[model samples]
Target: MGELKLSTKIGYGMGDLAGNLLFQMTVIYLLFFYTDVLGISAMAAGIIFLIARLWDAVNDPVMGLLMDRTRSKHGKARVYLLYGSLPLGLATIAMFYAPDLPMGGKVAYAAGTYILWGMLFTLVNIPYSSLTASLTDIPQERTDLSSIRMIFMLIGVIIVSVATEPLVSSFATPSRGYFSVTAIFSLLALFFFLLCFRLTGKAASESRKKDESYKLGEIWPLLLKNRQLLIVTAASLIGNMAVFIRETSAIYYVTYNMGDSGMLPFFLGIVVLSMLAANLMIPLATKKWDKKGTYLIGSAIGVAGSVIFHFIPYDQTALIFLFGALSSFGIAAISTVGWAMIPDTIEYGELVTGKRAEGISYAVYSFSQKLATAVAGITVASVLQWSGYAANIPVQSDQTLRGILSTLTVIPVIFIVLSMGIIRLYAIDRTTYEGILLKLKEKMS
Candidate 1:
């Protein structure tokens, strides 16, 4: 591969920008929409989230295998970006569409659209992620690319965070507001996907051709043997719990616990801005410390912030924002370094297994992320349900507020600690990665 132009970096970043626009919206608001807007119970909404993501357990890898087998002029991964973009956009719109229906009908509708959206998302996301490995073999370049991608992703998050509530409130009803904003976002997502396809062109397919010799049945063993992949996957699964839990619980914390709905945007905005600032520092951090060391630093920061937020009273708004920003800064580091680590693991897998299975590697990683999302959803909902949370209530009970606070703070801290422990076992430093790349080149020669 040649040096990546600045345009190529921005083009690659655009795909994530599009993805986060819809995905961040879901992470932040889907449960709230299902319960408060659609009148579903918290537990039921949680079940919907669980089932939809569990279905991805099957759906994501299938798309991975499909992408691995695809032989198209558009490239193994970019082909999906070209063909899957519009349908994914449509599914995004449908996911937010609230139909007038009975409770059962509402659950059924939510389940169907969400599952469909998840499926299409896999179609695009697995390939999009796989492209990281396909685009470049250089470790430093991959790190740089991942940083640029996170910057765009945070931009998308900031847009959704600051804009969504106001957009929804501007309409006649919350339902209409959500629907309209999603529709507009979906269109914007479509355009960005196309731009990504155009700008990224074809991925390097030489290794992919060699990958064709492996059976689909071999994917499991390959991933299992690639110890780095499993470590990162476990770390991602646990780390995402912290992220999703905070995101899903933020609205409730602001509205019910803090007693101010208007603060939602400012609260989320600070988090996103903190993440953006943290992202800008990732390259510097990675330069000063190895990825693992950088990741551990992030975990420590996140845990500290979570602890501070847990002790601070809800009325102390400035303190809350300051601590939340600290936590989000840590999350940004964890997420950015984690993503850059994946492409390195792809080469590691190739060195161990003698096959490059970027699609399946990323697929399994994506599956773990979705699994984390499912668990976070159910965990948040179940706690709320058990705490006697009621939708549309002017004020929640002390128990319910406690449950919300725990979900936002303490539960996330536990997972962040676990993720740090898992990541500690990762042994792939720069020296090991370089050795793996050298061995792969020798094997190819």
Candidate 2:
């Protein structure tokens, strides 16, 4: 195989940039938008979020099997980027738009659009992520590519986190502002998706031409036998739950506990940027310590920062940002290395089973991630409802404030700690990974 080109790496990165434009908004602002702006209760919003993601959990693997079996001029995974972008963008706009409807209508609208968005998101993201394995078989190259992809992911997060409020304020009211902001994001995301499609098309064409077919019936056993894949999936499920809980609670935490809603983008930007900075250091860290060692250290840092942030007086805004950045840095390290490990597991599966199932492997990972998000959404929403949260109220009860703080900090730390334990069960370290790749190549030859 030839050296991976820089342009291809960047184009691949743009795929995540396109994805996170919609994804970050959902994580950071979608709940807040549903409750505070659209007049839905927080609990209802949370349930809607959970239901949509649960649907995606089922839909993701189906999309993966379809992509794996698809024979197309554009390539299996890349074709979705071409066909799915417009629908995904349109669904995003629909999600943020609030029509003047009765309460029942509003609920239906939110649920319908959100579920549709999740399905469309599955169609695009599973394929895009699967493309990573198709793009290269080299482990180091996959790690480098994952870092590049995550950098763009952070850029997408930063853009939405920092710009949403200001953009909303730029419009006449919050409702109109949300529609306008989502519209802009949708268009930009569409353009980038197309760019990613083109670039990956050039790179994946040869592999797609030689790709082997698998029956739908074959995927289940392949997944069951890939113990490393299962271990990583469990870890990703819990780790992402922690991330979603923390991210979804940020708007609430800033508004009620810190009493400064305007500073949200600034703080969120700090977190994402800190994560971006950590992605830059992944290569060096992985060189010294394997992915598991690096993840252990980073998750430890994240847990410590989260615990410290939980106890700090809510008034210390500067200190809050300080610890938030520290925690985000750790989350970033865990995220980048964790995803880079997936392609390694794909090869491990092929080595064991004598069949390459990159699409199904990534699909399962996506399922775990979406399922975790569902759990997180339900958990946060339930806490808010039971804790007496009143949407759009001028003042929050002390209990509500405590609920937000606990969800934002303590709950997520517990989840991450559990995930670290799961990570310990993952058996593919550097030496194991290299051996798996070598064996797989020899078998293919």
Candidate 3:
């Protein structure tokens, strides 16, 4: 593979920053908005989130198949990003701003628009994910891209963390956090999606694929038969669920368990520090342990953090937060390397199947993420409802506090432990990934 120009790296980095700002914000605040500000019950909110995610499950592979078949001089994947950004942005805003309607009607409105935004997200995200493979087949360049992309993604997460709650308070009634925050982010996302479109240039596919047309039946077999992809996807699904819970529960835990709303910012700041620290370590960690080891070390730390959190006294809020930082340190490394692994797995799929299903591969990957997030949303909301959770209520029952703590401490520990086991099966160590890239380069050249 030829060396990547600085422009290519910088361009891709900038493009991801644009996409992630909306993506991260949606993941962080979407459910919160549905439950707290929308006057929807937590259980109802969970059901809504699950239903929308089911829509993603159906739509993701369809988008993947469509993207795979797409043909343009600019390349198969980049064209969609150019054209699809606007619709995605529009629907994203609309999802949060449906007309004033009855409760059932409002739920239906959110479900319809939310599903539409998700489809639009896949239309762009699957193609965009596959674009990394098109950039340069060099293993090192792939790592560089992943590192920069994840760093920018964290920057976006920090933006959502810092901005969404405050932004909501600024826009509508403080009670309507969901509507206001989503509206604000929708505009912000629109701007960035367009920026992503402008920043990324198209790359010509090296070999014209004979089957650049979607075969509806062939897609599933292609994904299912790839044993390595299956294992990685399983791990990704579980790990991502853990991540969503960690992010989603912080508000409930802080407000109800600790009795302080101000601590949310401090807790998130620890996350920022942890992510920054991980970003700082990327270059050095990759050099020392390579991608696989970095990820293993990360997973180990995550589990350790979960276990430690269980033992921490709830009364000692400050100390518990410090442990939280330790765990986020682990999450940071996973964020950096986990994405890099996805492309590698896709390459492995190509090796085994003699088919380039980058769109399907990335779609399935993102689908797992969506499913995990969806499950997390439903579980958290259901638990909140069952535990007698009420927003800004004068006082939560002891049962509610216990429920929040159990969800925060116990359920996540189970999933993270399972994540570690799945991660252990990921066969594409750094050596194999680099070898795959080298072989691809030689064949292309």
At residue 281, candidate 1 shows an lDDT of 88
Q: Write the per-residue lDDT of candidate 3 for residues 1-445, one digit (tens) a residue.
A: 3466676666677656667766765666677667665666778778777887877878898888888888787678878877887787777667666466789987887778778877888887788777677776666677888877777677767777777666666655754565566566666666665555555563334423446554888888889867777887887788777777878787788777887766776777677768777876776787788776777788778778777887787679778888888877886665567677777777787767767788888899889877887888887887888888888685799888877876666787777778778778878767787787677657667
Residues 1-445, candidate 1, lDDT per residue (tens digit)?
Answer: 7467788889999999999988888889998998899888888888888888878987887778888888888778888988898998898888888898988999999999989988998999999988788788777888899999999999999999899999999999999999999999888888988998888874444323554566767778888899999999999899988998999999999999999989999999999999999888888888889889899998899999899999899899999999999998987777888899999998898888877888899999888878887888899999999999999897999999999999988999999999999999998889999898888879999
Stretches of candidate 2 off by over 4 Å are 208-212
Q: Model 1: which residue pairs collide?
A: none
Candidate 1, which segments miss by more than 4 Å at Cα?
A: 202-209
Which structure among the candidates has the greatest lDDT? 1
How much does each candidate deviate from the true structure in C-alpha RMSD? 1.3, 1.4, 2.6
Arrange candidates by lDDT, descending. 1, 2, 3
Whole-model lDDT, model 2: 0.86
What value does the lDDT take at residue 60 in candidate 2? Answer: 77
